[model samples]
Every structure is written in structure tokens, then in C-alpha cells.
Target: MEKLRYERPVINKIKAGVPDKFGMSTRINTITEIEGIPVKDIIKGYGSPVFVLSESKIRDTYHEAYRAFSTRYPKIQFSWSYKTNYLDAVCKIYHSEGSWAEVVSGFEYDKAIANDVDGGKILFNGPDKSDADLIKAIENKSFIHIDHFDELYSIIRISGNLKLKAKVAIRVNMDTGIYPQWDRFGFNYENGEAWNALNRIMLSNNLELVGLHTHIGTYILSANAYGIAASKLSELAVRVHRKFNHHIKYIDMGGGFASKNTLKGAYLPGKDTCPSFDDYAESITSAIINSEIQPDHLPTLFLETGRAMIDDAAYILGTVLANKRLTSARRSTIVDIGINCHWSLMIIGH
Candidate 1:
């Protein structure tokens, strides 16, 4: 019998108005294969809804971010943010690229340690840090970014009692003309809170203030905001140097870089609209390079970007289990993957 060659008749009326945003025609960007293995072959072997991460894309994005900073600034460090995607494979890829671990929780910290990240290289940042957590951080000689006064006091007491000096930085929150400012996470820069926090840390002999940290917001499209943030951090660094004669080892502009996934109500697609690595590099590096801080004293730049680095490389491939018609006859796809499993998928579709 002759084989039947059946193809789905996909037809639609051509719409007008905005041209192709990506400058490419609207077509199915299908993934027929991966890593020399056909998609069908993979499905036959593993099953549907299996996640397929492209090692190439992961390395490429990491290189992109690394190059952006390393080329612009002399000293730069990238700490892989754990909360973004703690998959062992994903973390290993980043670690292999020489990225230190940037974890937000005790669990993530433990995971980083297990991943073979050096204790001194791991950066501990978050609002909630248990007593046991502080002890671990101090003992391991990790860089702890203090979020609140209570945490600072706790760390000081722990350091004093244990006779151990803890390397630390203050998470400073600044307004950079962005709505829904992230003031809750760190000490405010405009207000004297950040200064006050710095003073307290400096006064404590057990706490070695090592750097300045700030994460303005997430999915931030405004590159200029980074410029403003960098300027504010530089100002703090200069003030600390002038008064206390202390030079921080680094300045951390914590990750808020948008991934290639459109946010809800976003007019332009993120892949096209989101600021590129170059844009972020320009804003942040320019501010630091232009700051009054001496060139020789320019602290290392640390980026805690997680989403932008791994979102594109990781894909949740799911088979269409069922297709139903909506009330308006629009198509609704039910795949093997759900919202819980593929949180980033919803962001892309939006």
C-alpha cells in the first residue's frame, strides 16, 4: 500500500499593522531535534513532557553575560542565582563556567556547598537568615549581604560570641525612577538607613564590610535604571571610603535583568524589547567608570543574574494531550506540563 502523506492544513488571513517585531515572518519555530537526537526519537525513548535543555545555549548565554562585563570592566564576577533554577545540571553548567553560587536561602546555600562551590566564593543574600545559617556563613567565610538591622545585630552577636569575623555587605535599596520600588528587601539609599547600616557594620570589629549589594527589581526593562543604581552604589562606596577609609572589595548590582519571555501586558515581546547584555553593561559600567571613586580602587563588579542566563537554554517540551475549543471557538491547548512545572512557559506565552 502507498503511504499517505497527510499535512495539517494551516491557513489564516494575513493581518496588517505592526510589521514583524523580530524582523522574521510568523512561522512555527519548532524544535524537531536536539543534541543530534530527533525530537521524535527522544520522545520515543523518554516520553512526552520531558525537559530538554540545550547545553550550547546555556554556555552561550553565560559567555554572553561574562563577556559583557569582563570586556567593559577589568574585574568582574558572576554568581549564579540559585532560586532561578536549582536543577543540578543547570548549576553544574554555571559552575563549570567559573561562576560562584549566589543563593538566597539556607537550603540553597547548602545546595551550593554540595555542588562543590567554594565556601568563600558563595554569596549568601536574603532577608531571612537563621542563627544556624549565620553561623554556617561565618564559619565558611561566605559573603553575606545583610538585609535588615536585626540580621546585622544577630550577625554581630554571633561573630563576637564565636570570635569569628564575618565578611559582609549591606543590601541597599534605591529608587531609580522605576515603579513598585523594591524597598522591602534592603536598606534605603535615599534615606539615611543605608548609611546608618554601613556605620553599624563598620563599627563592629567582627563584621568585615566587604561589598555593596542592590537588586532594584526583576524583569527590569529600563537599562537606565541600572545606571542610576550603579551611581548610587558608587556614591555609597565613596562615602564609606572617605569616612571610614574602607574600600569594599566589590559592588553587586543584583539581578533583575529580563529574560527573553514577554511579561503580561507587555506591548513588545521580551526577546525584542528586553535590554540586551550590551545595554545593561553600558548602564552599569558607565556609572561605575564615571563615578568619583579612584580608578585603582574600582571594586569588582558582581552580577547575580539568573533568569536571563538560563531561561532560554531550558525548555519544557510537552506533547499536546488534548485540544479543546474555547467559548469563542478559539483553541485551548492542554499539554502534559502544567503551570507548576513550567512557570517560565506562562511568562513566554504572555
Candidate 2:
């Protein structure tokens, strides 16, 4: 004989979240694992508050991005932006994936060299290059992206003193119809500053114009803006070839490609709105390929995307320290990690 057990009735409360236009809550599914490893196991092994980087994911992402551009353009070169992550392991992973180094500081340049990156393959870019940095870059024959006239002339002077033809390029800043234009870093395209800088580089005996570079803006959702930038840089390349009979080695579309992070006020989900690798490839490649530049003399396309490449590969794993109700009656969880630091240098960049 079986005895029937008395059961207690349980009540459940369902909380309604704010819904979007279609009346669907945009709640994201929680992550339970990364790369087939359970979060519990990972925390158990490495402890919470540790940063985990999936090497497999990094290689996969690099290959995916490389494929997106390579399938569209014949000459495409990818450089790892050292400021993003720049952990020796991460940098080595990218370098092993055939990405050259794109450094914005003497320290990064040195780190790249220490990583056994060929000095000639490194790209030195930024507004601040010390005299010592210039000498090292010149000695190494790295691609020096000139930020201003001061740097251009300084490189010319240094190169002349060293009796070496420094491989140089001017960073062209253009109005790509994007808000908060990044006009402060390089020469302006609309106001003839870019052209003037090109002419100055062409006129220098100690400097060889190797490329034309432009970094429009960051987190740009518009693919057409990249098309505009590509077209302008291509036009500049054509003009340089037509005027000086010197073909530039590459067109560096300095990376500002947005990662899939929704802004504070974004109505649409980032996955739905942000441009994909294919979208950017189509825009930039199509514009350059269809430009007035001769087909035979088309320059190499260089992409140095950072955040988009490494964002998904690594994560800061932190355990919740406390659950508290604020005076405003809002619920919040305090985590172990503070934003004040990292490998320290990972957060230190331009």
C-alpha cells in the first residue's frame, strides 16, 4: 500500500520587462559556458575575477575577418593594433595568424620587435613620436604614418641625417559624414591639407611615400561612410601616381569598425544594426576597386581593427560580491573586479 503525500501549492510571480516596438523583451540569454567549458569549472580552476582568453576564438575570428576582405580584394594586409590587448600571448596569436604589428607608441613598437615581428612589417602611427622613437623607426624602416607637418618634417630631417629613405605615409582625416569626426589626429581632406601633405611627402628626398591612411571615426554604423573614405583615399593615390609617377604600396583604412556593442540609447540591437565584416569589406573594397586608380597599380588594402577583433575572445570573469538594495530602491550586484586597472597596459592606449 502506498501513502499519498500532501503537496503544498507554490505561487510564482512573473515580472514583465520593458518591451520593444514589437512587444518583445530584449533580454539576452545568460552565458553558461565559453568554448565548451562550463563557467563553474572555469571559475573553479582559474578562480573568479580572472581574465580568460580563448585562443581558439582569437584564431577563428582572425580567419573570419581575413576571409571577408581577402575574398573581395586581391591585395589585403591585416595588422594587429597593439593598443588593443597587446598581451604578449594575444599579440603572438595575431602575429602567428600573419598579422603585422600596428603600433602607436615607441613602447608598442619595441614590444612588437621583442615578439620577433619583423621591424619592416611594423606600422608606426600616432601624433606623439619621440626623437628616439623616430630614429628606431627609421633604422628599422617601419611604415611611419605621419600625423602632422611637425612629424613629417621631423622624419624628413631624421631620415636625411641617417642617410636613409624612410618609408612614410600621411594620415588623412576626412569628413565621412559621421558625427564627432576624428579631424584632430591627421591632415584634413576637405580643406586641401591632405593633398598638401602628400605633395610635401612626394617632394622629400629622404622620405618615400609608401601609403595613404585615414581613420574616419569610431563606432560608425554607416558602411557608406567607409565607401566615401575609400573613394577619397583612392583618388589621392591616383593623384600621387599621376603627379609623381610613384605608386604607393598600400591604402591604410585605419580601423574604426564598430564591434557589436549597443550604445546607451540605441533602439536597435547591435547585432542587427552594426555593420558586419562583409558589409565593411563590400563598401571599402568596392569603392577602391571601382575607383579611378589603374587596375594594375591598385594598392594593398590594410585593415587594423582592434576592439572588433579581440572583444569577443577575452572576458574578465568576476564573482558577485554582494547583492544590495539602494536607497532609490534599485537592486544592484557588486562585483570583485574594479575598472581602475588591468594588465595595466591593456587599458593604456590612444
Candidate 3:
């Protein structure tokens, strides 16, 4: 007879009158393999605390998101957010999928260029752009999303000095009924600040107001918020056309679409609670289509989805270091992974 397999004995103290949250199933799910490779074998070869990314998953996710938007909107463009994962291979995958580069800093802008992404296809965003960065963006003919009046004036000066029309857009922040509103980055929409910035840009004559951009917030749970943002951006586009007789080329709804990751203190898993790609696409596209903007002159819809696109495609493998019993007889398990692992998964809840 074969020897009995060794098993670690576990004892449980049951508390009466308490029900398990996961009905009938108390065992936690275990990840044994990824992309047909055994986890143990991978760990044996690469050691513990290794990061693994699935190329196929990344491509598939990109296609899924692209299809969601492209099928709904007449014209749609996706600019891969560089800050999410600036790894060369990751960026190349997106670029191969026909995504433009959306960088938030000078380093990312350079990374996009190094990746051979056409400078014209890069969308430069963020609030800390240096004067040199502005010059490079203008020289490359990239679309620069102005975050404040100072950046706006800097771009105007750069364009005047270089004698090149800087293609630009104003980053608009609005009240989308989300808590802890992200009012720090861009011009506010409600208090007429966004319109005021647009007026200044139009008056400058050196900068071409190419688009209207807004990123409501991150891990945005409400799809209706995007609809509201789309409507507001559409209103701005219409106003710009009417006032200056110049059609805005695009409306960039900067990405904050939530990935399928559970948030702390949540009753339901994020996989079940988060809005699907179709849900977001429908909300945004429908609003723009139903807006006051003319159908024939509808601006191109641009998305810079980052977390939702790449989060699920990557996983960090780590070993459990030790297990011990606490003073209350509760089990405590320590793993090799640390806060560093959590950095990449930021905005994506565990």
C-alpha cells in the first residue's frame, strides 16, 4: 500500500451563531499556474517575489476595450497611459495595438519617443512640464494638455519663440459627484475657469486649441459620471466652435476606468461591482452622440485607460515566509511581498 500523504493538521474553534460570508465555501482560491506555466516551476527558476506579465492578456484586454469604444463611437483613438506601466515590452504591445502614447512627464515623453512612437501621436499631460519639455513637445508637434494658466502661458511663449503652432488642449476638471474631487490638476469646469482658460488659449493665436480633455477621477465606480463629463466636454467643444469658428479635433476622456480588483471594506468583489467596458463606452459615446454638437462635426473620442488595461495582465508571485498563532489564537501568515509590490497595483485594490 502506498504511504499516506503528509498533511499539516489544522484546528478551528467555531463561534456559534455566526455565518460564513462565502456560503458553503470557506477555502480560499489558490493560483497554481499562469499562462500554462506552473507557479512552482516558475518560482524555482526565477525565485520568489517575481513579477509576471501575460502578453496575450494585455493584447486581449486592449482589443476588448478598443472594441467597446470603437463599436459605439464613429471616431475613437486610444493613447496608452505611460505612467501605468512604462516597461518597454508593455508599451510596445500597446503601440503595436495601434495606441498612441499619453505621457504625464518628460521622462515618459522621452520613453515614448525611444519606443519609436511618432511624436505627433504622443499626448503630453500633467502639471510639472518644464520649459524644455514644452519646447520638445512643440518641436515634435505633439498634443499638449495644458494643466494651468502658467503652463498655458509657457506654451504660448514657446510657440511664439519657435514660430510653430503648438497643438494644445485644456485639462478640465468638473464636479462629477465623486468624493475628494481631483481639482488639483486642471481647470475647473463649473466656476467658468475652463472656459476662461479656453478664451485665453484662443486669444493667444500661437497655440491651436485642438481638443478638450477631462479626467473625472480614478477607480471611478459610476459610469454616469463619464456621461456627465462627456456632455460637459461636448458643450465646451460646441461653444468653442461657435465663438472661434474653429472645430475642436478631439475630446480626450482621460482614463480612470477601474480594473477588476477588490477594494478594502467593500461588500462585493470589484470583479462583480466594477462597470464593464461596454458600460463605460455606452455612457460616454451616448452622451457625445446626444449632445448639442453637430453629428457631421463630431470630435474624435480619445481614451487614456491605464489601470484597467494592464492591471489584470500582470501578477506578482511571492512565497509565504512563515505562519504563526497570535495571542488570540488567530493565525498570522507573513509573505515575502512588501509595500513595493503594492506600488504597481496602486489604485487597484487588493
* Model 1: residue 138 alpha-carbon error in angstroms: 0.1
Q: TM-score of each candidate?
A: 0.91, 0.90, 0.92
Please, what are the lDDT tens digits per residue for candidate 3 over residues 1-350? 55887968898666452335643223346798887788877788777777888888888899999999999998999999999999888898899999999999999999999999999999999999999999999999999999999899898888999999999999999988887889998999999999999999999879899999998888999999999999999999999989999889999999999999766555566798899999999999999999989989999999999999988888888899899989998888899987476423211111
**What are the Cα lDDT values of the candidates?**
0.88, 0.86, 0.89
Looking at model 1, the pairs that clash are none
Ranking by TM-score: 3, 1, 2
TM-score of 1: 0.91
Q: Per-residue lDDT of 260-342 in model 1, one digit per residue for the tens?
A: 87665555566889999999999999999999899989999999998999888766666878878799966677888865664
Error of 2 at 67 (Å): 1.1
What are the runs in model 3 whose C-alpha is more than 4 Å off?
A: 1-5, 12-28, 341-350
- Tens digits of lDDT, candidate 2, 94-172: 9988999999999999999999999899999999999999999999989999999999889989999999999999899
Model 2, residue 152: distance off in Å is: 0.8
Residue 307 in model 1: lDDT: 90
